[model samples]
Target: MADYNRWMNERLYDAAATLPEAALFEDRGAFFGSLFATLGHIVAADLIWLNRFVQLPALAELRGPLSALPAPTGLRDRVADSLPMLRERRVQTDVVICDMVRRLEPVHFDEVVRYGNTAGASQAKRFGPLLQHFFNHQTHHRGQASTLLFQAGVDVGVTDLNALIPHEA
Candidate 1:
């Protein structure tokens, strides 16, 4: 998992690094009219999930001037900041998940995880499902970014999880 994550993380940054500010902020018909907005959403979502696992400040609770990365230059710098945060969150949450997995003798994958939902309402869902949602959410948005990158002529290579894994020793 670590090696695979490391490889993908490196790829993400490499792809991000190649993009020009103009391309990064181009309105390619993404959710918010720009690739930069879509990338911001991805970073924000990662932070939200991290908050759920590690008791960090909720992304929703972050009230301040939102840094507008409306240009490819600004977007790339934001991506630079976001990649490390995503990596740190992944490592920290993975530790918590590993501990949870190890401690359970008869694991209840259906155990509920309570949190506030998107509409600002409190909610609960099975842990297994939520974890699945977290990774799936990441993949979904990353694909959006990848598509945008391709449209901008940046080749974001090999995103498949299978390719991320190491061969058996």
Candidate 2:
């Protein structure tokens, strides 16, 4: 899933690069109102979740560059003010996510994580489900981004997960 997330992100950014700066930042009625903003939200959320993940006692010893990174000030805050900056940050964040996932042990999956939401509400949930939400959140916003890209005349080709699946020999 981390590889798929990275693959789609690369494709999305490549397509977005073809767009004019104005079009990239233009409001297109997506949740965050623009492709740039939506992309920013994805990065912000990833950092938030990763920060939370690092806080887990079971995962503390595994902290590295990801934990050293600062958390976003808010859910909707722009981690990067421009497309190029956003793409750079996105690449770095994706690498961190891939590394974090690689380090996880099977036992980590069953452990519960406790964190506060953006609304300041406290919550506790199993680590496995939280990880699912982390990836799902990316896909959900990426869908909005895909729509925005299409409306702007860019098509991200072959988004199906099957594209990543290996065929039996």
Candidate 3:
């Protein structure tokens, strides 16, 4: 899933780069209002979740790097106002996610993750499900961003998950 996240972001950004600078940030009446804001939201939310994940002992190695990414106070908070900065953060965060999944143990999956939501509500859930939610959240918003791109006359080709699946030898 980490690979999928990175792959999709790369494709999306590449496609987005083709758009005129004004259209890239123009309000399209979407959930986040524009492609830039949507992308920024993804990075911000990702850093938020990574902040929580790094609190776990198993993911301690992630602490140092993730600390460099700003912790978004709210989901809509802009993590990067420029496309280049946003893309850089996305690449960095994806690397941390790949590192995190590589280090997961069976025990870590079932362990409860306790963290506050952006709403400041208390929460406790198993790490496995929380991790699932984290990835799902990305896909959901990415889909929206893709649609926004499409509406603006850009087509992101081959978004199916199967595109990333490896064939057995």
Candidate 4:
């Protein structure tokens, strides 16, 4: 999953880098209003989840780049003011996520973590499913980002998970 996340992000950022600054920042009517803003939301959400995950006693030893990142003032806070800065932060965040996943033990997944949602509601759930949501959330926003990219004339080739699967010999 970490590999796939990194692979997709590389493709997305590569295409995004080719886009003109005005086009990338233009309001294209996407959920977050613009491609840059949408990407910022993904980074913010990832940091928020990683911070929550580390709070679990079973995962207390886990730490990475996210620990040093400033908490988003809100879910929609712009973590990066520009596309170049956002891309840099995105790569850093992805590395932290991959590193965290690489260090996870099976027992850690079975533990439940308690944390407050962005809405300020308290919640508790198993770490396994929470991890699923973490990755799924990335894919979700990336889909929106891909659409934004396509509308701006960039092609992010072959996004299917099957592309990463190994075939039998």
TM-score leader? 3
In angstroms, the error of model 4 at 53 is 0.5
**How would you encode candidate 4's per-residue C-alpha lDDT over 1-169 as one tens digit per residue?**
8889888988988999999899888999999999899989999998889889888765566564566675774779888888888888888888888778877889989888898898999999999999999999999999999999999999999998889999989
Query: How far is 68's C-alpha from truth in model 1 (Å)?
Result: 21
How many steric overlaps are in each model, in order? 2, 0, 0, 0
lDDT of 1 by residue, 1-169 (tens): 3344345545655686577766666788887566666756655564455445332222222222122211122212243334445445434444444443344433445566677755567887766677667667767776887787788787888888888556998
- Which stretches in model 1 have alpha-carbon errors above 4 Å? 1-6, 55-108
List the candidate 2 regions with Cα displacement exceeding 4 Å. Answer: 67-70
Kindly list the per-residue Cα lDDT of model 2 for residues 1-169, writing each as its tens digit. Answer: 9999999999999999999999988888877989999989999999999888987775665467775554795889878878998999899899888888888988988888888888999999999989999999999998888889999999998887789999999
lDDT of 1 at 125: 74
Best by lDDT: 3
What tens-digit string does per-residue lDDT give for candidate 3 at 41-159?
99999999988888889998889988888888799998887788888988998999999999998889888888899999999989999999999999999999999999999999999
Worst 10 residues of 3 by lDDT: 78-87
| Model 3 pairs in collision | none
Ranking of all candidate structures by their lDDT, best first = 3, 2, 4, 1
- Which structure is stronger by lDDT: 2 or 3? 3
